[model samples]
Target: MTAADDSTFLNISLPTGTPKAERVAFLRLCTALATASLDPADAIDRNLWFAEAGLGDLYNKPTLAAAANTLIDLVEQGWTLSTAYKHGPLLAPPPSNADPVVEKARVRRQEHLRRDPQLRKASVRRFVEGMEKPREFKGKLVTVFNLMRDGRELADSLTTAPDPGSVIRPYIQIVDGSRCERTGYLLHDIWRYFRHTWSNAYSTVPGRSMPILIRDAATPHHAVIGLAAISSPVVQIAERDEWIGWGTDTFLEEVRKAPSDEIAAWLAGRIDAQLGEIYLEDLLADNVLQPTDLHHPTNEAIAMLRADAERHRQKHHRTPLSEVRQIEQDPWVQRATSHLFRSKRAAMLADTLEASRTLRPFFSPKPAADGLCQALSDTKAKVQLRRLIRRARGERVGTVIADLTVCGAVAPYNALAAGKLVGALAVSPKVIAAYRAKYSRPSDIASSMAGRPIERESRLSFISTTSLYGSGSSQYNRLRWPAAVMGGPNDKWISFTELGRSRSFGTSHFTDETVDALVRLSRVKGAVVRVNSVFGEGVSPRLRKVRLGLAALGWPSSELLKHGRERIVYGIKLVENLRDYSLGIDPAPEYLLDPEQADETSVGVWWFERWGQRRAVQPAVLESMRRHRLVRPISHGARVPLPTDETDTTPTESMFFSADSS
Candidate 1:
């Protein structure tokens, strides 16, 4: 199975010769067969499974054998074994055909449902329960409890003659977290049932979150036009990070270089805070400490350290600071450092300063800034200024910006492009204010872990979302707002510009049950699981679990974690200087938009005139509304979309890697 003397994956061929596409396809076909649960000794079952999965058309027995041989060739040529999925659709990647996005979603759904049978039933059950007390108004379904007092014209207004804005006043409402009866429940219901084709399990969403409903600002029955859930943005987006320069080598270098003397003086003044972050980093680099020892020494962290020290003792090594094996766990570990430890710590700090960005995650801003502050004669102003300037890399990005995770209009409103309205209004001042208020308090988990209230700033910088499909988007396309109206300078504006394609690597393709198993397996393996779903620990906890879990299962982390299904990344900068602000260079963020200058009412009016009215006048829209009124069994536009093929789909909520993901 080894490659011929000079063969590589791209250059390998059948004896008769094969093109590059054909070779990749062969490798892809080989990869699919290899991952399947067929008997390794039996070509029959492998070929059968490949055919059944619809990947056999381009492959046959001899070609499939050749594919396997080519795979061996690849392995010989240093092709990673675990990322076999990357070679091609492991099993039925989207075919080049009409509605490929929908088709691909169908494949994903089929795989999920195949893994978990109850997902669809549960989704339908919850959806039906939400409509348990349905009240039909014409053909469209309605319920008393679900009704908003928004001024969306009912029935007759479906074919309304006037500009819909005058008769139908639209506004945005932040879902009241304290109450789940109206906006909250409706938001969840609509998002779970309406927007996506792959999955819509909103309960899976995590981190500090804000839910918003685009509603008609009317009394007695405000119709819910759309819903959006804003939470923490994904911390690692290559394109977005490249755009903002967060934690990038160049940005961190510039910041460090700008404060040239301060950086040097800080490294010299206090090598380690009483916390021993520096000592821990030195030990960690030398395989002497675990990541758990980074912060305050909790009982669990101490337990890990003790276990490791015990192992070291077993190996006849009396490591310095090993006395902590018997020390009662405390908030901070007080170490009487040896000259060796001190010199090693100093060397590590020197290396860290030399390559700050490369090793930024392991170091904390506080210890370094403390040292700098002390070196600069620690006065209140100097300390505060140093703290402000030396804010950690991930902290601001985690709290200051949010993602428009679950966003879209229901069917009836969707027909009017109200989803676009939802997109525009999602980034409105209402969302910003709501986010600020909701997360302004000290974080619960963070406070508990640190043994103090960790008050984090909730200054919302901008909102970002990804298109459902990788190919393109229709909803947030050209979704723009004038900055002048938003209290910014006349020349500026706001809009969700397509940032770029997000990394087509994630665990969304894996089912929840599958991920749960992977996590369990990962925990059993002992080293793959890192972030403990702890607040302020890291971004994308679920992503961490799934990816690490895969490694626990002995799969290639990056290759299998990769779905290769890229979604469009879109973002808007609420602040004039998102990059500088994210880097902590700007002491105060200059907001490009303000809540006072214009509210949801104004955004809705713009939506109404700009898109809704025009869409309403279309004969097609009128006919659709008329049909909606006549249908016996009312759907009410909350009908969930499925991959058109309707193959046994996984629970069709939103397989979008979820909200906090983006």
Candidate 2:
């Protein structure tokens, strides 16, 4: 056998107890005789077999001699050519009475059973019916529709246009949670339809969402055209924060400072008011203070003040002071008590001074007091306070954009371009005010008044939305809409891969099939090889050389590596990413429609195009790749090389590179 053939056999796992030298020699001899059209029984001459197998020089070697002696022993033991030459014992006894005709009939029967038309039709029908029916989703009754309905509604709405200023002009209204039982149900139905028909996967609408319903104003019943569900903004998004000129530092600082100020002010005010209402003279007059009392009148007054402070703390959810002097000279306290207790006519001036002295040390350091107050405050209250403060600071702190988690127009309305109107109304001051008002109530006045009032007019800065890539009906990307034309810079803000990784805050819909395909592909070839260098031997050098060769061969370096990790030690360049060299074109929807059908090359091309790489590799680096067996030569007219260990054999018309002459 040639070195290549020997290498191939050696790669296979050998059976246990098989002597390595004897097994190699036996396989080589059999392979050589088989290739030379000579029976193994006639090739017992070791020299002739060795020469044919291209191992003549090793004939006299100890390993070969042992193998020859083993073969002689096996022959003497009555082993025949057929039985002795076989690699392993039969896994199962040969089939009895084997018949090609019967086997063919059985295979045909299995194929027919697998392709049963009735079964296939029943399954498809069941799926379509399930998609058509209304079902409870996310704790609400939601209606569903298929893509056919989506396309039909869009066509009808486009052909019919309502007159401008007509009562039929579309308008968006906030769904009032308290009174929107019917509206909420309708919204869920619309969302279910959108999700079932348009979204790649289903996700429950987030809690505390404000559902906006778009309706035709001119229509007598205000026919619903679209639906949008807005939810709380993500706490942090690098792109959004950078765009709004708010860095991580500024955001953290403001969040920390605002709550601290509010807590401190509130505590100081409560303490001052409670202390002012109590007077030492009044306590003495009530006969609560006696001349012979063990506690001084001033001490009794301080005790009464402390008790009052505790009651105030419990009532307002403030932290009770472990020490009494914490709020003695608080600015808010001094301001509140100055006129009532520190006036020239005050009868208990000495006692009040003593009380202030007792309180000074406790409130001297605001940080300790702030920490105590924060710990004692209700968690919900603190969060609400922070949100209010963030709103009040406006664009300086960060832009408040409505996170449109679910935004899509209904059948006829969506077709007529009503989604843009909904998008516009989402950020409109009037709509925002209505949405705020619907949730606001007299009962919430106390809580609302606790935070500094935010100006609603300038609070909202923008609106953000996302859609699947290549989706033609994405409203966010539709340029003709007034909202799109009036909006700020429009670009692909985030990629699906990034969104998929961040489950907590990102909005991406990855179907089960896509995820499974990705996992399977990753297992086969997506995993990167770790190159741990021991005594300077590592795969990194080979990889680097391969990269250089590809670059020298006109392959783009930016497209060489893909985003994936293996064992967290090596960054793997996927075979899929190699499509950039094989097919230098962007991927089309048909190419990526089914991930299961996607091979490494097609996936790499799709990923490359999806990321929009513009950089190209320098020719100087191509030499390195050539030396590392990373790339192989192909035919003159072929863009992709034939099936080799280095390249995929799957033929494609979209090949990028011509076969290298060298």
Candidate 3:
């Protein structure tokens, strides 16, 4: 007490109860600062290291100025100095309440490298370094970049923190490109820095030297491993909002826009793939920070679980899920777990089925529920059938089939329709019976349809028997019809089911007419004729049923309704081999053929058939051809004869036949 009291009285040893470790750390930092104080050349590392120690709270006075002051103090204290000059005193003083000791340490450290020649040389060296030569891959970095951007936009358009996986899976193509991979590499570097700096505070091994989560040191391997280095471990453990909301579109766009190179393209693809994988994890997150219905059953189930968790949380602040389940019987949750493909049964069964040869990988694979898989298979079969019919009819399905099939993509129509049908079958016994009768084997049908008359005598029975409108409404849009009815592989095709209805239906009654039409059809028996309008302005109603003969079928007042008068145009040009001469004109094999050209409408039932087929094709050739055509028509052009330039020596064969056919 005597020594301490005397020291305190002399103000040499203030009232210091701070931990020994902290004091040691501070002294070490001071020593480092002192060592670099006189020389401005060593300041960057000196101050940067000090700041890294969590003294950012000090060295203010416009940072550089504070560093200059720190340098001056260290110099006065007779500390070793480097060959550099101090930058300057900070223009503004640090906060009045800031700790002077910390401030002094930071100021001193920062001043060490204020004018170091080596630092300048290092910076210049980096600028002068040459980058690796560019490479080429299957797809362009720009395209993938565009896809990411589009995917992000699509995801953000949804109400929830979109089903992260679905956000990228549908739009991003995993073709050969380095854009995504490079991005991953960049992310790796960034995280490496963070990890290295972080470890200094907590771990013995330097962060940079330590392996990332996956432990693979190989660059390509590291690039492929998505979870190796997330933004922050805390965010990951807490499931931070940023993690939930991590979309790489903006970052990817930059990658895409980078100079066209193989490395860039490949990296882009890798990054996209990684993003897609992360998205899937996010989709599987229990609590969807941004909830979206546009996700697969597994994702939806996860979101539902999250919602249930939130509900439980609201009810019993911070109660664990296990205990909360004991409090209430949750059927919605149970059913979701069972049918939504996240349940243990679904996972096991799906994995088995996927491994088996009986099921198609795209239509039926791991983690898919039996019912869902069957529905997906049926939808896929129907799509294949439609495509076959379309190809037979003459449609041009894009080359996205390989992508869609391998990735297990279901057309919006397929999802919507199958979902609608499945819902209906689950809820309506008649619909189930009808589907069984129509699709099941005869023996099975005979066993299942025992005793009941083949034909039922009610509208509900008929609809149930037909399996037209499924039981549950869509999760995305309740008022709108299921996408299945429209029958296309794209969202655009699905829109047909709604008759070009605007998305702003909830805002006005105009769309109510469309809903009314659907409702009328649902309620009315047999063929009913109802004239509906978009504006809800025209509604002519008449109650009448017409019978054609004594035992003839009958029709209700509703007409066989047609869609609105919107005409989509398609133009066709015909090319034919013109040859064989008889009498007069022996053309130089090619001539002006404008009159032989014809423009025709691309309408009718066969239009879809002509354009809805897919084939394995290289995109590079298609793109090149397109560009070539844009510059100059790939097909030959006709040469017109001019009276002035003609030598009047046109060859006229003795037995030339009529060659031009219009």
Q: Identify the leading candidate in terms of lDDT.
A: 1
Candidate 3 — which residues are off by over 4 angstroms? Answer: 1-135, 138-208, 211-662
Ranking by TM-score: 1, 2, 3
The lDDT-based order of candidates, best leading, equals 1, 2, 3
Query: lDDT tens string, model 2, 530-591?
Result: 21211111123333433333232222323322111110010101112121111111121111
lDDT score for residue 429 of model 2: 39
Model 2 weakest lDDT span, ten residues long: 563-572
User: lDDT tens digits, residues 159-196, model 1?
Assistant: 55454466567776676534333333444554444333
Model 3, CA-based lDDT: 0.23
Clashes of each: 16, 18, 67
Worst 10 residues of 3 by lDDT: 398-407
For residue 139, model 2's alpha carbon misses the true position, in angstroms, by 30
The best candidate by TM-score is 1
Error of 3 at 1 (Å): 36
Per-residue lDDT, model 1, residue 647, is 54
- TM-score of structure candidate 3: 0.15
